[model samples]
Target: MAPPQPKAAAKAPAAPKSRVKKAKLGKARNYDLGNGIVRFSKTKMFHKTAKYKFVGKKNPKAPKTKKATIAVKPIGGEKNGGTRTVLLRRRKSFYPTQDKIKTHRHHKCFRKHERNIRPNLTVGTVCILLAGRHAGKRVVLVGVLPSGLLLVTGPFAFNSCPLRRIPQRYVIGTSTKIDLSDFKLPAHLNDAYFKKNKKSAKRSVKRKEGEDIFATKKEKYVPSEQRKTDQKLVDEAVIKAVGKREDKKVLRGYLKAAFGLRSSQFPHRLRF
Candidate 1:
């Protein structure tokens, strides 16, 4: 019998594809507006890489010693006697990726800095801290920062309420207030604003003082500026006081009093 035809040679396996490594991505923080709209904080990203190499100077092909239509002397750092030549090339230009073109994005809005904010909570509003060392403690709302952080103060005479920024979600608003109406709010207030406040007198009507109503010269240096160290000490003390409390029973009691809730009350944090 005729020998069986040798089986067709097995086709060589196709070469495996080289996988391109995915670029590392940076995490972006998200914020929620009162409405359904959500805001993504500015992303930390490197600018796009240059697209094309920089254009080089055009020079005559022929050497200057040979003499040509163009100047024989090199315009740039080319051959010293003949046509000009480029020494160090310039940086390449930036080019965008195909993916970037598919999805166009605006980086930052002009209105990002201009806030038309009218927050419901104000300075001196009684708040229940729901997070951090000051969590479950009573704190007087300090002021709404431009960045929308609730700058709060525990005044930590007893509670460990570090003067810190609690996310809006962790702050529980209550009907209590510390009568800060007499206090003047500042433009773009921060934790330091509280320090200046402590050093100055409240904005109460000035009474007759020795019947001498003379123009008080405004000192170039205010005494309040010097109390930064003291303010920092207070902040540290408040944070320490809150962190040291393990039982937190007193803290819970304070929370209950601020919210006016009973043992059976299943009160949840108020969200706006």
Candidate 2:
């Protein structure tokens, strides 16, 4: 009785309730006209009306019209069976003829994107082989092939790499170039020159009655005499040209040493 009581908290006013209006649908009616004709009318919600007029009788037992057909002869001839009837319309193809033609042209036009070699990559330039069986080997660029590959050689006598064709992308061109004014590649060393001959199947030799087939030792593969002559000719020409240069010894040493990265070395930051 001695403490004053706090007044009751005032109640918040209530929000007004929203009302939604409903649409009323009207009745539909149909009127029958003379000679199998009928008119229909329907009133929809929101005061919208639709009307339709139909012709012909509404009997479910009426026969349907048949499609036109033609008789086609069988491929095996009339002896097996007469002609079979087919619809007049042609069958649709699974794919459009235009799309088929476009696909054929796309495949025919597909070709390797040719990349231009670096400006330093010229005839007589020294390049490092970056891929294939001769990766990391330094070779001399002799010429360019019709297929855009680089024709290079290790002079056979220096690094044992003979005349070969390699893609320009797999080679890193250096600033070094040699004097090849007097040296010229042989005319026979084209793309066809490197074409490998198909070896014939080994013939099974008939042994004598007293002879044992297992006694004969298998011979090791040896390079042909023609290949030896070619290698000798190319090596002699390249070595003679290199011998005339003042830095011949240095160039020989560079080609003999294989390319490699050392610890704390980055290829991008290093000079070729």
Candidate 3:
């Protein structure tokens, strides 16, 4: 080996510096990393050594003051060396829970008290007609008019009476007791019933006349002559009606007795 190469100098290893130590600042619920790194607890916030500084004391020379109260002045205050006067300021009140304001509508213009109308005259009142063409009649008041006229209906026959003829005094609108027995229904004549009853009465009279006509007594002489003449005419009629019927035994007997005809006799045919 060539003169044992000058023994190579032994290489010296580089010295290792200390790893960054995790730091603990005061009781800030946080940790610090060496070389100016700060870690906030439970948050990912980080700060450099220069940016993250300790909180310092507040300034001590600042002035202090208390809150001021609001001031109210009178509206009509006098100026210096001038006359003073009084002024009133009124504000309308608003009540949300108060009852509603009352308003009236459709009040009657007709004064009941002024007119002396009985207080008892209410709606659906019944009244009677006192003076008119149909006096002593009854009616019902439908309403009171604005002109103080009473609107009434029926005395039945006197339904068309004017309002002027009706007196307020006689018109008893409110009565707890009304005797109805004296009141009669309106008179109405039925021509059909009258005609039927008259016809029946006439027929009864005719029947009695017919009986009398049939029942009159006959005079002895005149009646006998009449009987003979009537019997002859009746015989002719009977002979004409019967013809030549010897087969009817009862008819033959009647003819024999009525006419003086024998059973075997040849009778002449007589025209009536």
* Candidate 1, residue 137: lDDT: 69
lDDT by residue for model 2 (1-272), tens: 58998999999888877777778765444445667454542233213332233335375877989766675755566576755666577777676657433432232332355556767888888899999888899998888765677888897778888788998889999888777767777777777777665754354466878888855444455777876887787677667778888998898899899999999999899888
* 1-272: candidate 3 lDDT, tens digit per residue: 45755778888998898788888666653556767465553323434333335447455787879544433444544664344343344445875788888987433554543444566554334454556564544444434444345544442222333222244665655352222322231222122211222222222222364376534343332324533453344234333333444444553333232123357765244221
Residue range 1-272, candidate 1, lDDT tens digits: 99999899999999999999999986434546758455643332111222233336565687548433343345555555556544354545876565444656655575466543335576667687777755666776756776557877666454545456767888767665445554443443464454343444433344466754553433354535434554455445433444455744654356334334557766654341
Judge candidate 3 at residue 139 and give its lDDT: 48
TM-score, model 3 to reference: 0.20
Winner on lDDT between 2 and 3 is 2
**Candidate topping TM-score:** 2
What candidate 3 gets wrong by more than 4 Å, as runs, is: 1-114, 155-165, 174-272
Candidate lDDT scores, in order, read: 0.56, 0.76, 0.42
Candidate ranking under lDDT, highest first, comes to 2, 1, 3
Candidate 2 is scored at a TM of 0.51
| TM-score head-to-head 1 vs 3, winner | 1
